[model samples]
Each structure stands twice: as C-alpha cells, then as structure tokens.
Target: MSEADYSRVSPFWQIEFFYCNSYLQSHSLYAKISASESPMSEMVEVVIDSIRVHLMAPQRVVVLKQSSTERYLTIWVGPYEAEAITVALQEVEMIRPLTHDLIKNIFNSFGARITRVEIVKLQDDIFYGNIVADAGGREIHIDSRPSDAIAIAVRAHVPIMVHRSVMDAAGMEPDREVPETNAPLARQEPPPPPSSDDANRLSVFKDFLDKLDIDSPDKDKPDSP
Candidate 1:
C-alpha cells in the first residue's frame, strides 16, 4: 500500500513500534495508538511484579510495575489505597485490616471473586482498568486504579493483562539493574549500643591516668631543695 494510502488506513500502521522510555510511558503511548486505531487487538499481555512508594508524594499515591522492568505505571490514589497496596506488596504486619484487605474480605463474604484485571482503555492521558469478578453467579465489571487493581489482582491470584496496542505504545524493554527510585530508602540496621560496664571502666581508667599526667610537675620536687 502507498504511504499516503496507508496513513489513511491507520496511523499506527504507518508508524513503527519503537522503544519506549519506560513501561508506563509506553502504556501511555499504547493508549494513543489504540485511540487512533478503531479496534484494538488482544495480543498484548503484562505482569504486575510490584508496587513502589515515591518519596516526593508519600501522602498521595504509589506507583506500580512489572517485576521484570524498571519502567513503572504510576497511579494517584488515596491514603487508604496506598496503605492497602503497601501492606500487600511488602507482606507487612498490620494491627488493623487495611482498605484492600477489607475489600478482599467483603468479596469473599459475599461470594464474589476477582477473576482478573484488564487494562482496557486509555483516554486523555488517563489509563483505565477493569476488575472482572464472579458474583451471584454472574460476572461483573468494576473500575479501578491500575495500582490498586494490580495489588488486588496479586492477592486474588488472577492474571493481569494489558492491551497490545497499549503495549506497543507504552511497553518498554526490561532493565536488569535496579532503578534509582527503587533503591533502599534507609540503612537496614542501626549502630550497636554502648555498654554501661564499658563506660564505667573507661571513666575509672581516665581518672587513674589523670593522676600520672606529665604536664604537671611533682609537688614534692617543686620546692628549691
């Protein structure tokens, strides 16, 4: 097909799927591609590897990503969503049930189950996700954050997927090295504590040493003898 004719057919077809800076950035690109193309293909698949909390906005939301890549899909979430996803990712202990935990509990209590999370659409720079659930003998769809949807998907043991068009636009090649933002925030251990016995011994040693100081002349030899 002629280049001009191909452009008229589909703009995405005209452009090659080159490398994306990051997966999230790639995803944003994919959304644009899908929008330009009428029907999206379902060939693309993505895995949710983990979630990260950015230091810049600890109070806001967290970022999500696939374990295999340095690129991340960021989501603006509430405090509760952040806490829930954090606990779930770290497997940390919480005295009280977190919001995500409660959601899972409610789902179980009502005989509803999350089947999978599908990143369905992207529009106006925003990515949208759908939670496929089986409840009351019927499947239902609910809107969710890509971060929260991913966190819950991990707990529910459901597959996480992305559209191929989105992948083509937003998918990035995975980097083996750790990302700068994902580095450890603080040292793992604190300095060892000083012992009281060692302090007392040092104090006594100082006192005895002070008595034999060469800086001072002997009192007995001071007089003109």
Candidate 2:
C-alpha cells in the first residue's frame, strides 16, 4: 500500500507476542492485516486470541506482528509460560499450581521478591528479558524469556517496561478521536430582550433634535414682500 494510504489508517500497538509453527504461520498469514491500525483494539483482539489458542493446550510460541513497521517479534516460551499468560488474560484460575505460582512460592520461601521485568534487548531475532529482584537486601537481575518474565511480573505486581528504542521502532501513533455516536439533544435557550433604558435615551435624543428645528427653511428664510 502507498505511504499516504498507510498514514490515513489508524495507528496501533502490538502488545502481545506469540509463537507458531510453519503450518500455523502460513494459515494465519492469510488473515486481513493492516498497518497503522487501532492499538487499543488490537490489544483486545490479542488477549482474546491467546485465550482461544490456549483452551486445549498451552501455546509454546507466539509472534507479535506489527504491520506499520513490518516487523515480526518472535518470542519462544514453554508451555507453562503460555498457560500462565493465557489464563491471566482470560481471568480464569486453574485448580492446581501453575508454573508462575511455583516460581512465586519459591521466591517467597527464599525471602526474595521480584521488582520488575525489563525487555532489555533484541539480538538475532530473539528478544531478551530480565527479571529484577531484591534478594539479600541487594538487587539481582536474572535472564528470562520475555513471555515468562512478563507472566511472573504480572503476578508479582512488578512493573513491565521495554527499551526506548524498541518502543520507538515498533510503536505507532494513536488514532484520532471519533465524533460522538449518540449525543443527547440539547434544549435551546430563549433570546435576550432589548434594554428599556436605551430606548428611553433614544426618545430623549429625538426630542432634543426636534427642538433645534435645524431643517426648518421657513424660519431661516428672509421676510417676503
């Protein structure tokens, strides 16, 4: 598509990454894809897709495709990683201990706590993530899969942040606001009345002009023989 056409489309953000096999990729690629689409809408759709993909078994991989930048960020994850994220997105709780639950319990036992998750770098088509934690009164960083890190970070109430460069390269401008679809009808106010004081003043002025007789030619003319 032309650049102008692309710009006219709404901007969007690719928030989730997924993994897919060759067959799945080929089948999925046939779906409608547009650059500069609505980011908020896309995020909602991604969450819904994750739930659907994980219904039978946890997804091991997912790809985040950004049409604007034409970039595909592929993230490799384990089954547990997929299940935790997908379940969280679906707002459903599993009966047994999920992987993230076990990790959180281990951290609690060790008196270590997760502080944040950082998407620090992207190398060789692999996005690297780090988990920042407080252990022994010192901050420690552990290398982790972006998906796993995010899943744990969400459960631990830790912040998730991406590098500035990544955001700049992948982020799209937000779409413009749309007009109200169903605004209530407004009542019309009555018009204001003219001032009585101004009318009186005008009448007084006219009386003064009449007293002057400025245009009376008979009074100003010489006496006739």
Candidate 3:
C-alpha cells in the first residue's frame, strides 16, 4: 500500500510521528503518525502499563501492553532502572537529579528532542532498544538499553514501540482467540509465535502478572487518544 492508503486506515491511537531528514533515508524509516493520519510502520505502539516486582530473584519487570489489545510484552530490568521508570511514570519529584533525569536535562541543554523510543529487537533473551532524537534537523538513533529507553520515553511522554517481530515472539494475550479488527481487505499471513523458545526464556515475566501487585493494563490505562 502507498502512503496515501495508509493514511486512510491506520488503527493506532497516539503513535510516533517522524520527519524525514537525510539520515531517515539511510535508516529506511516510515512516519509512525501525523496530525492528520496514523501511518503504518514495522513497529507497534505500546504503553508502559505498570512496573511490577515479585519476591523472586531479578523480580523487576516493566510491562508494555499493545495499545489496542490485551497482549503484553514484559521486560525484566535492574533495580535502579525499575526505580527510574517508576519515578517517571508516577511523575515523582526527586530530591536530586537521577541518571535519567540528567539525560533528560542534557537533551534540553543540547536542543535535541526525543521523537520516540523503541524496544527495537529481541535476540536470544536480550532486548535491544533505540532512543530516536531530533538533533536540530537530523534524526539520530541512539543505542540504549530497553530499560533506559523506556525511562527516557516516559519522561518525555514519547511513544514506546516494539517491533512486530519482537511482539510476535514475546507478546502474550490473556485469551487464545483474538477477535481480529482493523483487518485488511485482502488475505495475509498471520504472525506466528516466535519459536516457543521465548516462552521458556521469558516465562519468569508471567509469574507476578497473576499476583495482586500487578493489575490488568485494561483497567489501569485510560482509553487511548
């Protein structure tokens, strides 16, 4: 489909909108949205539904719920990282600037604005991310840890996205059958679950999900804009 076609029927609510510069072509990127239309991209927009921790070791998990569905993508992160994301999510005023706070201030100091943050890839159990920033007129993609990217995103109120392939691999829905919506008129291959290896590898993330501290994203989140 062409850009005009995508403009007519995108399902996203509030997603990333990137402007093209010389660096954009090198990256082969598409605009995730516009004031007028939601543009399609390889990534799916998600929200930081909640930060959860369990009694188990390495317990901190950051949950990303697909914007329009119950499907979730969870990433286990370090303690400091979890706290940074939590502080940002809760809009807490810290006594002193934390590391992420410093990063945000630096962005302001340098005149670079964060356009979006993405959990770009998942490989062997490690998740990779990018913080996309607009440096003057050029778009810069910075390599970042997923936790750091999310921490920064929440601070900037930027869209956090996961690649479709990563979602297919790690995303889980509460129910087995999803009543599909926003379907294209033509037939297409359904996305497959990423080799069951991920289920085994990332299974720790699902344990606290059913526990009391963790709440369903549907209830916690407001209706998307």
Best by lDDT: 3
Using TM-score, rank the candidates from best to worst.
3, 1, 2
Runs off by more than 4 Å, candidate 1: 1-43, 53-80, 174-225
Model 3 vs. true fold: TM: 0.65
Q: Provide the lDDT at 192 for model 1.
A: 86
lDDT of 2 by residue, 1-225 (tens): 566665665544111112234446655341322122222222211111121122233434444434334333334567566667666555566777778878878878889888776666655546676677788887666777788877887678776655544543332233358576555546545558658864553453233323433354443222221
Q: What would the per-residue lDDT of candidate 1 be over residues 133-219, giving only the tens digit for each residue?
A: 787777666777666777787677787766655544444443478456754668545658758864553453244323432343342
* Candidate 1 TM-score over all chains jointly: 0.48
Residue 135 local lDDT, model 3: 82
Clashing pairs in 2: 10-36, 12-39, 18-62, 18-63, 19-61, 19-62, 19-63
lDDT of 3 at 42: 84
**Model 3: runs farther than 4 Å from truth?**
1-40, 176-225
- Where is the poorest 10-residue window by lDDT in model 2? 43-52
Decide which is better by TM-score, 1 or 2: 1
TM-score to true structure, per model = 0.48, 0.44, 0.65
The superposed Cα distance between candidate 3 and the true structure at residue 160, in angstroms, equals: 0.5
Candidate 3 C-alpha lDDT tens digits along 1-225? 468865775455213333334457556443332121112378899998776665445557788899988889988889888878877776778889889989988988989899988777778779988888788897767778889989999898899988888898788787578577787847768678767766676575465556524345444422221
- What lDDT score goes with residue 176 in model 2? 56
